[model samples]
Target: MPIRLASRSLPLLLGLLLALPTSLHAQQPTAVIAAEASLESWYDPLEALGTLRADESVTLSATVTDTIAELNFHDGESVEAGQLLVRLSDNEAQADLRAAQALRDERRNTVNRLAQLQSRNLAPRGDLEDAQAQLRQAEAEIQALEARLSDYRIHAPFAGQVGFRDVSVGALVSPGTELVTLDKLDVMKLDFTLPELALGQLEPGLPLTATSAAYPDTRFEGEIDSIGTRVDPVTRSVTVRALLDNTEDRLRPGMLISVVVNRAPRQTLVIPEAALIPEGHRQFVLTLDPADEHRVTRREIRIGARREGEVEVLDGLNEGQLVVAHGTERVRDGQPTRLLGILDETTSVPELLRRGRDEAEASG
Candidate 1:
């Protein structure tokens, strides 16, 4: 049970703290637990709404006007890089290629014949030049035909999940027509916005946790991948981007998620929250003087953040000094008190809080 300092304990504590003439202090020796203040590192984490985006996304389309000859992928199927996706009717391109090949063969023979005749001094230099120009022209035509054939076939640019398609075999598609969509979902880009005030803490590679209503029981882990170059003028918020692994392929693009960023922790002196005795707005704690355990003093303290049932002491205390965490109601300025056994140094913060709570409850 926590020790509750009440009017009854206060009188005894005041006498011990005040040193009340050696006679009075000796008369009322109030034993109290003294625990040393500890230095701990603490951090304040922030949460913001964010979105999931694919590592890569694209709406696949055709570059040439032609009839679709084949559709190689099914809706929602995974595909590999360079995998055939759609094949347009290549009759025209292939025919052009064959014709160019035949023309190139004919031109090559003509050039070889002209070269031999010139070597024999039977053909003029102009004849060989003309034949060579024709061979070059044929080669150029074959290249153009090959390029055109490529437009007739569509290959996956990267490995990804393919979305549904509206085009079917034998359907004619024009340039710029939408065929289907593909997304690289192995890793996702998570984007969120934070107020400009949080900009100071913004940095790359910080740890993050992401959760979504769609998957309430599960949490996804990630890290800040990048930050936006500028903040939104109207909203006064900066955009942050994070990278999350989706190897399990559970997280999808365009999903709404909640992101928690674990910022760097700062060091500070900390003590049990129960140690603070609040008198109106100001707070104070009772501590035994290091030089004399019999003398107790009231120390005013400024607090910062509170966590794990412990409060940060901004001032008026240093680490390793013993403080009266409980039975503070009885302690008064400059009182002399009997020493109780010190709290075990290994006792955890959670255990201390539980003990303090029980003591308060029992006293009530």
Candidate 2:
């Protein structure tokens, strides 16, 4: 009978030992990194590739064929509008101007003398009229010569920087020969294209940002100033133009850049992306009990758009509630938890873990 009692007691004692560990595990709180849901401005981003261009660009060239007489600018020199850049050979033209001026003076004297003589009846009316016509013709000739003289010179059309000089002094050049290039670099224009579906979200004065591989650490801010009226039928896309301030002259034409257009922006509740526990098609999060910080309850949440390190919580989560951001793998619904630290979009996970370890060592 004593032997029979010992066998029954052995099974009961084994059962108790197994139950003890299970109860202890349930009672012990799990350590986890948590993050608070908060409201922040969120933007839907539209990305595209863009090309940079100067606000105003032109290739300077001479309109008339002639030998270069003088060069007043160097390569990459800034000039003002109407500044004389090059003077072609005008020696022959100057001689003609002087002779025309002499003839004009002679005709004016004849006209004046004829008027006086006609008033005294010493000269016939026809003679006075003939001298007047001759005087007018001489003046017209001088004006025509002056206009032609302007063609032999080159002047800057606007205030900008000039490119390299392709020809030297005394080098004969013909019409359409490129002399230099001028560009107004105080402002830059960025052109990019987006699909036709994005047209409804684009308009003038919309703000944008751009980045370039040349300046890896820099970001350029601009706003939409123009939108194409027609969409490409083949590509189903529309062109957009933005204006960026280039006061530093860092941007240049034909540079490939990345563009981001901030479309719809609004304030929405957000949490660190790591806090979401995705199960198949649905999403869930572990939230701490307000009254009992060590107790956590698994919650099903609806989410919207996601940015960088955070996600927009559309439903099932309220602002200011804490959710598990780290160590979600070892946690379960209605599990007791110990708060390690609060995590945010800007927080580093490894750093947070180190801090938690240090705190644990201090407490022990």
- The TM-score of predicted model 1 comes to 0.71
Candidate 1 lDDT at 322 equals: 84
Number of the predicted model whose TM-score against the real structure is largest: 2
Candidate 1: pairs in clash: 1-359, 2-359, 10-330, 16-335, 16-336, 17-334, 17-335, 17-336, 18-335
* lDDT, model 1, position 338: 62
TM-score of each: 0.71, 0.84
For model 1, the local distance difference test gives 0.86
Predictions in order: lDDT: 0.86, 0.90
Say which candidate scores most in lDDT.
2
Task: Name the lDDT value of residue 294 in candidate 1.
Answer: 56
